[model samples]
Structure formats: structure tokens, C-alpha cells
Target: MIKKITIFLLLVALAAAAGYGYVTKQVEQYIAQPLNIEQEQIFTLKSGTGFNRVLSQLTEKGIIVGSDFSKLVRRFHPELTQLKAGTYLLEPNTTLAQTLELLKSGKEHQFAITFVEGSTFKEWRQALETAEYLEHEMSGLSEAEIAQKLGLEHDKLEGLMLAETYHYTFGTSDLDILKRASSKLQAILDEQWQQRQEDLPLKTPYEALILASIIEKETAVEEERERVASVFVNRLNKRMRLQTDPTVIYGMGDKYDGNIRKKDLRTPTPYNTYTIFGLPPTPIAMPGEASIAAALNPEASNYLYFVASGKGGHVFSKSLAEHNRAVRAYLKQLRSNQ
Candidate 1:
């Protein structure tokens, strides 16, 4: 009877060990199972969401098969129990273990919005309005109202924000992006202004920003920014009219029909550099850091004029006669192309 009882106990122990091994193998297979997706999928985990809810969501979306044994995965791998909330990208052929690892790592997917250099405030507004997954708080607000909300001292929003690609998580507000851009622009302007070259005609950092906006509009070539800045600086020193077409266009506002006639240049609006004699009352467009730097420290040159070369960039000149010659050449090139 004692031997029989001992054998019964030993058989029960072996059965228990076999059950444990079977459960472990099942969990391993569960972890190795690929997600039920053929393409990339965006998953959003809201704040205060629990691990069980995440699993339920995956199960509901048919991304994974439901199983009571799958929950035991967390018991084995304790790190999988802590799921961070944010937007995540689950790629095709990603295993269950890989997906859980990504969720636990808290690396949320990022979306990018770019505010292009030389774009006007109106264009920026349109861009913000159209950005995907971004919350639009500034939609119905006036420019002045938006400025006030951003804690700006003045209503002039032009050139206040920096031009660059800003990355954000899902549901980020347009105002939040604007605040970041404005803060970054202010910080960079302050630092650059402090290190500016001596004898610059710019009386304040705002003036430099205004000039930078004009320079940004004048040229798209990276290397030509300093030279373009030099032309404007020289014009400022000589008390000559800037006569830039972009300023005239800005002054025209919605009235500008893509063509600048003699009347538009002769128009006496505040932003029309042909008539204003000094810097515009406000910046014409957003300027990048390089443009701001070029405005503060222009290339040492006597150039006071520049015109489109009709091929790509602009041709710089020291005198009006030289500029007229360049303009004639540009027209000739245009005619030849036609």
C-alpha cells in the first residue's frame, strides 16, 4: 500500500510538469504569431488605457486571435504588462512579441508639418488648416486674435514664426506648433542679433527680420542669400528705393494677379518698396535662419541691383546701367526660350 501511494504521487508530479511544459510552449507560439495585417496600420492608445483594453482592441480589429492563454504572456514577460499610450505604427509581418515590445517602448509615431521659408502668414494659416491629424484651434480666429492668443505684443504676425519642419504627435494643436515656432524664432533672432557685424543699417532685430524676409523672397539659391542681402544693404545705405517686386506684391495683397505692371510698382502702398523708401512697416514673409544671418552680416559688396538671369538665379550689378543691361539679356533669353 505504501509503494502504491508513492507511485501515485510520482505520477501526479509528472503530469503537473507536463502541463506546465505544454502551457509554456503555447505561450511561445502565441508570441511568435504574426499580426493579421497585410499593410502598415496606425494604432492609437489613449491616455489611461489598460493593457487588457489594448489586447481587446487588437482582438476586435482582427489583428490578433483572442485567447485566454495569451494573457499569460504578461505573467511570463513582466515588461509587456506596462503599455504606454500614444500613436503607434504596426507594420505587416510584425510578430505579437514585436508589437508588444513597440507598445512598451513608448516610441510614438511622429507627423511632420513644414512652414516653408519665404511663405506669407496667410500661406502659413492655410498650411496649418490643412495639416493632417492636427487640431485646428486657430481656424476661425483673426490674425490679430491669433497673435493675442500667442502672447505676442503686436498684431503683426508676419515673419514671427520660424520656417522649418516641426514634428508632433497626433492631436497637436496649430497654436502649439505656432508657439514653438515663434519661441524658436525669437531665440535665434536674439542670438544672431547679438553677434551681428558692426555698421549694419538695421537699428533693431525686427529690422533685421524684415530684411531677412525680403532676402528670403528674393532668392531661392542658398549661396546667393548673402549677395542678395548685400544688394539690399547697399540700397539702404545709399537711400535708394528697394524696388523689389515681392514687396509690391505684398502691398497689392489679393489684388496681385501674378503680373506686375507699371501701375503696381508706382502704387503708393506702405509695403511697396518702390514707393516706401525704407523698410516695410512689417515683414513681408517668413525667413529661414540663413536669411536672417545673411541680413545681419551681408557680404562686403557694392552691389545695389539684381535681376533674374532667365535661366535659374539672379545676376548682380553695381549700377543701374549694368542692371538694365542684365534685364535686357534676361528678356532676350525669355524670347529665345519662347
Candidate 2:
């Protein structure tokens, strides 16, 4: 009789084990199955949002099916009360397991914005302010305040950031982007300074940066960067004024219309290269790597002047007469076009 009772207990245990195995298999299949989503979509998990809310949202959106999903999740991860919050791009046919793992990973979708090489600091700020995803922290802060936050010794804020497209997740601050760009600029400036050509007229890396900003504004042509750098470098070496029109317009600030008149050049400001005998007190625009490198390592040329070639380039010359001739041709072309 005892043996029969033992046999009955063994049968009960076997039945229980089989049932558990079947349930485990079902749960595994359920997790491995793809969701009912037909197309790609973006889902946001806001900060402090719980996992239950996330699950409810997903289910309501028809991204997930089956009423047992929540129960299965609870069975599998009862302790998982919350998901890391951020924007997520959900692809079609993504499995439940994949989605869960993605949420758990916490890496959000990254967005990109490019700061053009010759763009002003104000333009850069505008770009950040208008960007869709970036958090705008500097909207109310003055340039001086921003400079202080960046730990820049100079009160002025122009030309401090590096021009590059930076990728960041949503909830990222504009100041955060600026800080990264600033750090990048400092590193590049230091590295390029170490490799600068000998006898460069630049007194320091900051001087090189000022020259680089001018070079960046001077030409968009890649081949002309060194030539443009040479003109300014030679001018500096010979104590000739840079006489670049961009600086004149920059100095005019809000008063500058589309055209730069003779008076604007004659009107003196700290930034007007036409009036100033040396580099501007501060850079006028952000410079790129090529321009910065050209500033540090100028072409070995005695050419001291450049005029627009009327074909989207410049005509470099060693004498004022040649520059004058090029300027006359540019003016004539401008008149003919008009």
C-alpha cells in the first residue's frame, strides 16, 4: 500500500514538471514573436514614466497585441517597474524581446545639426534655438554670460566654437553642444599650433585663430585657402593692413546693409580690418580645420594682396598695382552683370 502511494506521488510530480515545461515554452515563443506593427514609428518614453504606462501606450497604439503580454512581462520581470526614458525609433516586425531589450538599453535616437564653417556665432545660436529636438538653455543668456559659462577668458563669444555637425539625443542642451564644440576647437587649435610653420606672423595660437577666422570668411574654394592665408600672413609680416571687406561689414554690425560703401571701410571700429593695422581684437566668424591649418601653415609666397577673380575665386598679387587691376576687372564684371 505504501509503494502504491509512492507511485501516485511520482506520477503527480511528473505531470507538474510537464505542465511547467509547456508554460515556459509558450512564454518563450510569445516573447520571440514579432509585434503586430506594420510600419516604422517613433515612441517616446518620457522621464519618470513607468513600464506599465509604456506597455499601455504600446498596446493602445496597436504596436503590440495579445492581452497576455502584460501578464507574461510581469511573470518574467516583476521587478521591472520603469524603463529608461527617451525617444525610440520602432521598426516594423521588431520582436517583443527586441523592443524590451532596446528600452532597457536606454540609448535614445540621435539627431544632427551642422554649423557651417563661415557662419557667425549668432547664426550658430539661432540654429540651436530653432533646432527641433535640442534643449535651448542659452535663449535668455547674454553672450558675456555664455562666455563665462564656457570659462572663456574673453568676454566676446564669436569664433570660439568649432564648426561641425554634432549628433545628440533629445533633452540635450545647446550649451552642452557648444561646450563639446569648444573643447574640439581647443584641441584642434593646440594640435595645429604645435605643427605650425616657422616664421608665422601670428604671435600666439589665439592670433592664429583670428587669422583663421578671416581665412574662413575669405574663400570657400579649398585650393585657395593657403593662398588666402599667404596674403594675410604676408600683409601682417609687412605691416600692411589686412583690408578685408568682411571685417568692415562685421564692424558695421547692424548698420551694414547688403553693400559695403567707402565710408564703411573708412569708419573705424575695433573689427574693421580696412581701418585696423593689425588683427581684430576678436575673431569675426568660426573657422574650420582647413582654414585654421592654413593660418598656421601658410603657403610660402610673397603675395600680399587678393581681389575677387569674378569667378568665385581670388587673384593673388605681390604688388598693389596688380591688385588694383584685378579689382577694376571685378568691378567691370559687376557692372556688366548689372
Candidate 3:
């Protein structure tokens, strides 16, 4: 009877071992199973979400199956329980193990927003308002108010932010983006200013920014920026009025209707370079690093004038007579095109 009892106990232990081995194999297969998705999709995991809840949701959405095994597998891998909350981009054919690895790794999907060179602060603000998944906090605020929030001593916010593609995660605020861009711009400006060429007419980095904004608006040609900067710098050294049309448009503000009349050029405003003897009080638009660099270190040239070539780029001139001829040529071309 004792011998019979010992044999029964051995049989029971063998059965238990087999069952345990089968369960372990099933859990491993479940972990290796691919998610049920054919294309890429965004998955937002909110704060304070638990692992079990995430698994259940995935199961309900048919993104994954066999949550029971996943829960059972989690008992051995305690690290899987520590899931981070953020927006995730789940790709097709990703296995359950990889998905769990991503969730626990805390590497969330990044979104991008671009601020183009020569765009005004108003345009940047509008872009921020339209950006997806970004928290808007600067809506309906005046430029001065927004500047104050960014800790800017100057009331004007123009040209303070850098023009570049900024990457951010979910729940990033508009103010935070502005702050980062502003900080980046300041750092670049400081670095450039420290390495600037000697004897530049610009008294401060702000003056360089002002001139850079003009250079940005003057030409879109990559090669023409330094030459354009030279013209402005020469004009500044000679105390010649800038007489640029963009400044007139900026000064006219809402009054400008795409055409710059002779009367508009003669009208005196703080931003009207034709009337103002010095640099404008603020930058007219955002300037990229290239323009900023051009402002600080201009090409050596005696050219003082430029006009649109009416084909592409501009015809630079060293004298007013040459500039007038170029202007007439541009008009003739314009008339021919019409």
C-alpha cells in the first residue's frame, strides 16, 4: 500500500511538470505574436494608465489577442509593468514583445512644425495655432503680452524666434516651443556676434538682426545674400537712406495694397527706411542663420544698388545711373511679359 502511494505521488508530480512546461511555451508564443495591424497607426496612452488596462484595450481593439497569457507572462517580467504614457506610433508587423518594449522604453512619437525664413511673427503665431497635438496657450494675446510671457524685455516679438523645423512630443505647449526657438536664436546670435568681422556698422546684435531681416526679404537667392548685405552696409556707412520698398510696405501696415506708390515711399514712418536715417526699431521678419551671418560678415563690394532682373534674381549696380538703367530694363521686361 505504501509502495502504491509513492508511485501515485510520482505520477502526479510528472503531470504537474508537463502542465508547467506547456504553459511556459504558450506564454512565450503569445509574447512573440505580431500585432493585428496592416498599416501604421497612432496609439495615445494617457497618464496614469496601467499595464493591464493597456493590454485589455489592445485586446478589445483587436490590435492584440491573448491578454490572459500576456498578464501571466508579466508575472515573471516585472519590467513590463512599468509602462510610460505618451503618443506611440505602432507600425505594421510589430510583434507583441516589440510593442511592449517600446511602451516601457518611453520613446514617444515626435511631431514637427516649421517656421519658414522671412515669415513674420504673426505668421508664426498662426502656425502654432494650427499645429496638431500642440497645446495652444498664446491665442488672442497681443505681441507685447506674448513677449512678456517669453521673458523678452522688448515689447516686439519679431525676429526673436529662429526659423527652423521644431520637433516636439504630445502635450507640448505653444509657449514652450516659442521659448525654445527664442533660446536657440539667442544662442546662435551670441555665437555669431562673438565671431563677427571687425568694423561692422552694426552697434549691437540687434542691429545685425535688423539688417539680416532686410537681407532675407531682399532676395531668395542663396548666393545673393552676402552681396545684398554689402549694399546695405555700404549704405549705412555712407549715411544713405535704405530706400527699400519692403520697409515702406511694413511701415504702411494695413494701408499697403501690394503696390508701392511714389507717395508711399515719401511718407515718413518709423519703419520707412526711405525716410528713417538709421536701422528700423525692430526686425521686419524672421531671418535665417545664413542671413544673420551675412549681416555680420558682408562681402567686400562697392555695389550700392539692386533691382529685380525680371527673369530671376536681381541686377546689382554700383551707381544710381546703373540702378536706374536696371530699373528701366526690369520695367521693359515686365511690359513685355504682360
Top candidate by TM-score: 1
**Candidate 1: C-alpha RMSD after superposition:** 1.9
TM-score of each: 0.93, 0.83, 0.89
Of the two candidates 1 and 3, the one with more favorable lDDT, higher being better, is 1
Off by over 4 Å in 3: 1-18, 254-258, 335-338
The stretch of ten residues in a row with the least summed lDDT in candidate 3 is 66-75
Task: State the displacement of the C-alpha of residue 214, model 3, in Å, after optimal TM-score superposition.
Answer: 0.6
In angstroms, give how far residue 148 of model 1 lies from its true place. Answer: 1.7
Q: Which residue pairs show backbone clashes in model 2?
A: none
Assess candidate 1 and give its lDDT.
Answer: 0.92
For residues 65-154, write the lDDT of model 3, one tens digit per residue: 864577786776676678899999899989988998999999999999999999999899889999989999998889899999999988
Higher-lDDT candidate of 2 and 3 = 3
In model 2, the runs with Cα more than 4 Å from the true position are 1-41, 46-49, 61-69, 76-83, 92-97, 335-338
Better of 1 and 2 by lDDT: 1
